[model samples]
Target chain A: MHATALAHSNIALVKYWGKRDRALNLPVAGSLSLTLGGLATTTTVHFRPELESDLVSLDGRELRPGSVAHRRIADFLDLVRNDAGITSFAEVETANNFPTAAGLASSASGFAALALAATHAAGQQLTDAQLSVLARRGSGSAARSIFGGFAEMSAGTRADGRDAHARALAGPEHWDLRCVVAVTTQGEKDVSSTEGMTRTQETSPLFEPWARTVDADIAQARHAVETRDFALLGRVAERSCLGMHASAMAADPGVIYWNPTTIEVIHRVRRARRDGLQIFFTIDAGPHVKVFCPARELSALRSVLSQIDGVNDLIVARPGQGAHLLES
Target chain B: MHATALAHSNIALVKYWGKRDRALNLPVAGSLSLTLGGLATTTTVHFRPELESDLVSLDGRELRPGSVAHRRIADFLDLVRNDAGITSFAEVETANNFPTAAGLASSASGFAALALAATHAAGQQLTDAQLSVLARRGSGSAARSIFGGFAEMSAGTRADGRDAHARALAGPEHWDLRCVVAVTTQGEKDVSSTEGMTRTQETSPLFEPWARTVDADIAQARHAVETRDFALLGRVAERSCLGMHASAMAADPGVIYWNPTTIEVIHRVRRARRDGLQIFFTIDAGPHVKVFCPARELSALRSVLSQIDGVNDLIVARPGQGAHLLES
Candidate 1:
C-alpha cells in the first residue's frame, strides 16, 4: 500500500519543553498549540516487499541510510511496522514549505504527516489519539499537530505512554487568531531541541520548578482559550516561552537559542503592545519570533515587525487543519 | 565628625538575585563574590548640627534634596543616626570610578563605603559584619562588598535581617583569579536590578526553584573555592549567573539583558575554552560579560576578546580589599 499525508506546522503557546521519559518521548508537562496554515509538510510512504531496506529523502535530497535524518525516519518507520505487524521495507519522502530545524516547528508537521502516511501505507487503521501517540514517539510536539486549531498534549501519568496524546480543544473557526512569524535567520540552530531539552533536564537546577509550574500555565492558558481572552492567553504563552528558554539557558554550558534579532523582535512586540496594539511574542528554540494577534491587527503588526533591521521575512498564518490523508 | 571611606565593587560568582523581603532588601538566596580591584567608590559623610537638612552630591553634581538618590542617602543617614544616638543632619559626597546603574555593581561599593563612612563619621563603631548588614539594607549585593577576595552573603532566616550579612571567605592573597570585563555597552541598562529582581520574584515561576537550589550551588561553589578548583568554580559560577538571568527572562514582560555583543563575548569565551584556555563567562543583569581566568592567560584572553566586534573596552581586575576608612 502507498499513502500520502499533509500536516501543518504548529507554534506552541504553552510549550512542551522537558521530557519525562526520553526513550518514550514523554513530556514532563502538558502543552497547547495552534496548527499554522501556509506552512506544512507533505510526506509520502510506500511499503514495497522488493526493497531490501528503507529509504528516506528530505526535500529531494536522499539521505544515507545510517545518517541521523535517515536513521530517525527509519526508526519511526520501525514503530509503524511493529504496530501494523509488517516487515516490508519502506520508502519515505518528506518536504517542508518552511525552513527546517530553525525553531519553526517543522518537526511537528513532519512527524505528524509521517505517522499518518506510514500507518496508512502499512494498512493500519488508527484513531486520531492513537495517531497522536505514534507521532509523539517520533517528536513530542508532533502530537499536538494531530489536531486542528487549539490542541493540548496531555502529560499522562501512565508509564506505558498509552494516555499521552493530543486532543483538539477547538476547531479552526473557534477564534480568528493569527500568527506573524518574524523570520530572523533561516539557518538551523546550533543546538536542536532534542539535545537542548535533554541538556536542560539533566543540568539546569531551575528545571524542576519550571516543570512543576507548567500545569498551572496549561490550565490558565486553556481557560483563556475557552473564554477567548486574548490578553490572558498572550501573557501565559509568553511566560511559558521565556521559562522554557530560561531552563535551556541555565543548562551546563548553556543553550542560548536567542540572537540579537530575537531580542529586537521581542522589544518591538512589547513596544507595539504598549502603544495599544494587542500583539504578543513567543519564540521557540531559535531566534525567530511568532507574534500572536487578531487578524484586524495584522497590518499594524507587519508594519512594526518589518521595520526591524534583522527580520528577514514574515509568514502570516491562521489556524489550520490537522494531519489528513492526501489523495494521490 | 567627618570620615571618608573607599570600597571596591564585587561581582557575584554565585549571584544574590531575588529578595526574600523587599522592604529590608533581604536576599532569598546566599551568594558568593570576588571583590574587584581598580574600581572603587569613595564616599565621604560629615555630620553637622547646624544643618537643617541632609545634603548629598554625586561626582560634584548636587542632587536635589527630595530626589530619589538624595532620599536614599538621607534614609541611610537616618539609620546611622538611630544607631549612633546622634540627631544631626549630614552632608554626603560619593563618586564611582565606573558607570552607575549599568550592572557594574557600583551600588555594591557605593553602599559599602557609605555604610562604613556614615557610621564612623557619626562616632559609631561597628564590626565588618554589622557594616555588611547595614550595606545590604541599601543594596543586596552591597553586603558582599564589605569583604575582600572571596565573600559569601548569608540569606538569613531572621526577620530582622541581622544574619543576612557578608563574610570574607578568602583574603586577596588566597587565589590568583583575574576577571576580564568585556564592556559591550557603556550605557546604563534599561531595567535596574532592583526593579528587575522584584519583577522576576513576583512573576517568574522559575524563581521559586532557582531560590530553592541556590543553597546547593553555594555549597558546591564554596567547596570549589576551598579546593582551588578553577574549572569547578567556573562551572558553578556560570550556572548561577545563567539561572539568575533565566529568572529575570521568565518575568511577565521579560527582562532580557544580553545584546549581540554580549552573545559574541559568550561564544568567544566558549571557543577560547575549547581551545584550552581556562576561562569562563558570567553576565550580570547587563550587556557586559566578565570572563574569569588566571593571570597567566590574561594576554591571550585579551587578544581573543578584543577581536570580537562589539567589545568596546576591557577592564582586568584581581581580588581586592573590602571597604576601609580613607584619611581625610
Candidate 2:
C-alpha cells in the first residue's frame, strides 16, 4: 500500500523556543503561526512487507541508511508501523518546492507530510488531531503544520504530553496578509534547533524569564488574530521573536545563528517601518528574515528588501492550507 | 578653590545594565572592570564666587548654557557643592586622550575625574569610596573607575545606598593583560545608555533573569581574577556581556545597538578563536568590541582586528591607575 501527502511550511508569530519535555517534544509554551503558500513539501510512503529495513530519499537523491536524515525518517515510520500493528518496512520519498538550502526549515512540512503518508500507507486510520500528535514526535513544529492559516500549538501541562497538539485558530480567508521572506545569508547553523533549545534551557540564565513572557505573547497574538489587529500582532510577534533569540544568545558559549546579512536585514526592516512601510520582521532559528505586511504593501516591501545588498532572494508567501492527502 | 584630576576609562568584565534605584543611581548587581591606560579624561574644576553659573567645555568647544552636557556637569557639581556646603559655581574643562567619537563611552572617566576634581576644588575631603558614591550620581559605571586596575562596584542593600561604592580588587601590576578596543562603527546611538537601561528594566521580558545571572558571573570573574584563570574569566565575562545586551535587545521596541560591522567583528572573533587565538570579545551598549588577552597577544590581536573591513580604529589598553590629582 502507498499514500502521498502534501503540507505547507509555517512561520511562528509567537515562536516555539525550548521544550518542556525533550523526549516527547512538548513545546515549552504555546505558539501561533501562519502557514505559507509557496514553501511546502510532498511525501510518499509505501509499505513493503518483505523488506528488512526502511528506505528514504529527499528530492531525487537517496539518503544513506544510517545518515542523520535517513534515521530520522525511519524512526518516525516505526511509530506508524506500531500503531498499524504491521511487521513491515517502508520506502519514503520527499520533495520540497523550496530549496533545501539555509534559512528555510523544511522539517515542519516534511514531517507533517511524512506523518500523514506513513500512517495512511501503514493502514492506520488516524484523525487530523491524532496525526498532529504523531507528527510532533518527528518534529515539534510539525504539529502546527497540520492546520491551515493561523494555528496555535497548545503547550499542554500533562505529564504524558497527551494534551499537547496544535489547532487551527482561523482559516486562510480570515486574514489577508503577505509575508516576504528575505533569504539574507547562506551560513549553516552550528547546532540544530532541537540541540540549541536544550542548550538554551540548561545554560542560558534568561531562558526562564523569556519563557514567562511567552504565554502573554501567545494570548496577545490570539486577540490580535481575532480582531485583525495587525499592529498588535506585529508588535508581539517581533517582541517574541527577538526575546527568543536573546535567550539563545545568552546561552553559555551562545547559539548565534544570525550572520552579518541577517543583522543588516533587521536594520533595513526597522528603517522601512520608520519610513511608514507598516511592516514587521520575524526571524526563525536561522539567518533569514520574514517581513509581514498588508497584501497591498507586498510589492513595496519586496522592492525594499530586494534593494538590500546581501539579500540574495525574496520569496513572497501568503496564508495557505494544512497537510492533506494527495490523490495519486 | 581650584583643582584638577585625571581618570582613566574602564570596561566592565561583568557589565552593569540596570539600576535598583534610579533616583540614587544604585546598581541592580555588583560589576567588575579593568581600568584602561590610554583612554582617559583630565578635568580641571575651578570654583569661583563671581561666576553666574558653571562653565563647561569639552575639547575647547564651549558648551552652551542649558545644553545637555553643560547641565550634566553642573548637576554633578551640585552634589559636590552639597557635600562641601558651598554654592559656588565652577568652570569645568575636560579633555580625553581618545576621540569623543562613537563606541567609546567617555562618561566613566568623565564623571570619575569630575567627582574627584569637583570635590577637591569645593574644599571637600573624601576617601576613594566616598568619591565613588558621589560620582555614581552622574553615571553608574563611574563608580568603578574610582580605583586602579581591577575594581568592583558593590550593589549594597541599603535604601540610602550608604553601603554601595567601588573598592579595589587588585593593583594595576597584578595582571599583565591587554584589551584591544575595536571601534567598528561611527553610528550614533538612538538612546542614551541610561535611558536604554531604564527601558530594558521596564519593558524587556528578559531583564530579571539576566539580572539573576550577574551574581554568579561576578563570583566566577572574581575567582578568575584572583587565580589568573584567563579562560574562566573570559567565559563568565563574555556570558555576562552577552546576557546584558540580550536583555536590552528584548526591550519593547528593542534597543538595537550593533550595526553590521559590529556583528561581523563578533563572527571574526569567534572564528579566530577556532583558529587557535585565545581571545575573548566583550561589547558595551554601543557597537565597539573589546578583545581581551595576555600582553603577548596584543600585536597579533591588533592585526586580526585591523584586517576587518569596517574596523575604523584600534586602541590598545592595559590595566591603569585610578582617578588622581593633576599638577595643574
Candidate 3:
C-alpha cells in the first residue's frame, strides 16, 4: 500500500502552550488557529511486506535508523499499524516548503501529512477527527492542522483524551485575513518546543495561572472570529502569545527567545496599530514574528515589516485547506 | 527649619513588584534587599513662611512646580507637614551619585533621604519605622532603603497601611558579598516602574500567581541568607527577578525591559556560574543587569562583565548603612 498527503502549517490565533498529558500530547488549554495557505509539508508513505524495519527520510536525506527523528517516525508508524492490524514495515519521506524548527510550526504540517499518509498507506479509512487525535500523539499542534481555516482544540476533560481532537470552527471562506511571516532567523532554535514546554511547566510559578486562564481566552478568540472582528482577534491573539512567552520567561533558569530584532518587530507592530493599521503579532518558541492583518492593510504591513533590519524574508499566507491524502 | 540626609540605594534580593494599595504605595509581596554602599542620594529640605510653593531641584536642575516629579515631592512634603502641624512651604534639593530612572533604584534612595530630611526639617522626630511608611508613600522600595544591609519590607494586612514598613535582617558585616552593576543602557526606560507595575497588575494574568508565591520565595531567601548559602540565595533571587519581569512582559500592551545586551549579560552570568564562579543576575525595570557575587569571585565576574559590548559603566557596591542625617 502507498499514499501521499499534503498538510498546511497552522498558526494559532489563540495559542496552545502547555500540555495536560505529555505522553498523549494533550493540550492543557483550548486553542484556535488558521491553516496557512502557502507553507506546507508533503509526505509519502509506503508499506511493504518485504521490508524488515521502518525507514524515514526528510527532503531526500535518510535519517539514521535509531536516531531520534527516525525513532519518532517509527513510533508513529507503530500506532498506525496497530490501528490497521498490518505487520508490514513502512518507509516515510517528508519535505517542507518552509524552515524547520525555527518557530514556523513546520512540525505541525509535517506530522499532519505523515499521519495522513501513514494511516492511509496502512489500509485504514479513518475520519478526520480520528486522524487529528492520531496526529496529536506525534505533535500536539498537528491536531489542529487536520482542519482548514479556523480550528479549535478543546482542553478536553476526558482522561482517555478522546475529546481532545481539533475540529473545524470555520472554513477559509469565512474570513479574509492575511499572515505575513517575518523570518528573522532561518536556523533552528537551541531549545525545542518539547523541552521548552517541559521547562516552563516545571519551573515557572506563573504557568499554573496561565494554563488556567486559556479557556476564557479561547472563548474570546472564538467570538472575535465569529464576528469577523480583526481588532478583537488581534488583541486576543497577541495577549495569548505574550502570556505563553511570559510563562517560559519566568522559568527558574529563565528562557528568553526574543532577540533585539524580535523586540523591534513588536514595537513596530505597536506603532503600526497606533498609526491606524489593524495588525497584531504572534510568536511561538522562536524569533520569527507572524503579523496578522486585514486583507486591505496587507500591503502597508508588508512595507513596514520588510524595512525592519534582520528580517531575511517575508511569507504571506492566506487561509488554506486541511491535510488530505492524494491518490497514489 | 532645615535638614539634610543621605540614603543608599537598595537592590532587591527579592523584588517588591506589585502594590496592594496604589494610593499608599503598599506592596503586594514582602521583599528583601541589600542596601548598596556607593550609590547614595543626598536630599536637603528647608521650610520658610514666605515661600509660596514647594520648589524641587534635582542635580541643580530646578523642576517645574506643577510637574510630576515636583508634585510627588510636594505630596511627600505634605505628609511631613501634616505630622508636624506646619503650614510653611518648603524647597527640596536632591542629587544622586548614580543615574536616575535607569532601574538602579534611585527613587528608593531619593525618597528615603527626602523622607528623613523633610520630616526632620519640619521638627518631627519620627522613628525609622514611621519614616519608612512616609518614604513608601513616595516609592515602595524606598521603605527597604531605611535599613542597612539585609532589609525586609512587610506586605502588611492592615487596611490603614501602618504596618507596611522595613525592618533590618542583618547588618552589612554579616555577609561578604558584592554587587556589580552592568549598565547596558544609560537612557531611561519607555515605561516607568509605577506605570509598568500598574499595567502588570491590571493586565497580566500571571501577576496573581507571581504575587501569591513571593512569601514562599522570601522564606527560602531568608533561610539561604541565614545559612550563608550563596548558591541558594542567588537561585531564589534570580527566580524572583525573572518572575517579576515576566509579569511585566505579560501585561496587555506588554512592557519588555530587556534588550539584547541585557540578555547577553544574563547568559554570561549563567556561564560564569557553570565555570565555577558564584555569580547571579537580577534586573529591575531597566536594561541594566546587576550581578551579585561572592567577594572571592568579584575580580573574575567584573572581568567577564566588563567585556560585554553594550555595558557602558560598572559600579561595584558592598552592603552599607541606610538613611541618616547628613551634617551640613
**Per-residue lDDT value at A14 in model 2:** 97
TM-score of chain A of each: 0.97, 0.98, 0.97
The positional error of residue B68 in candidate 2, measured at the CA in angstroms, is 1.3
RMSD of each predicted structure: 2.1, 1.2, 2.0
The TM-score obtained for chain B by all candidates, in the order given, is 0.97, 0.98, 0.97
Off by over 4 Å in 3: A185-189, B186-188
**Fnat computed for model 3:** 0.63
Candidate 3 local lDDT, A1-328, one digit each (tens): 9999999999997888888888888888888999998889999999989888997889889999999989988998999998889999988888988777557888899889999999888878879999899999999999999999999988788887988899999998899889999988443256777888999999899888888878888899999999998888988898889889889988977776776567668878887898899999999888889999989999999999999877888899999899988776
What tens digits encode model 1's per-residue C-alpha lDDT throughout B207-234?
Answer: 8888887898889999998989999999
Candidate that scores best on DockQ: 2
Evaluate residue B70 in candidate 3 and report its C-alpha lDDT on the 0 to 100 scale: 92
Model 3: which docking level applies? medium
Docking quality (DockQ) for each candidate: 0.62, 0.76, 0.58
- Report the C-alpha displacement of residue B78, candidate 3, in angstroms: 1.4
Docking class of 2: medium
Give the lDDT of residue B90 in candidate 2. 90
Interface RMSD of 1: 2.2
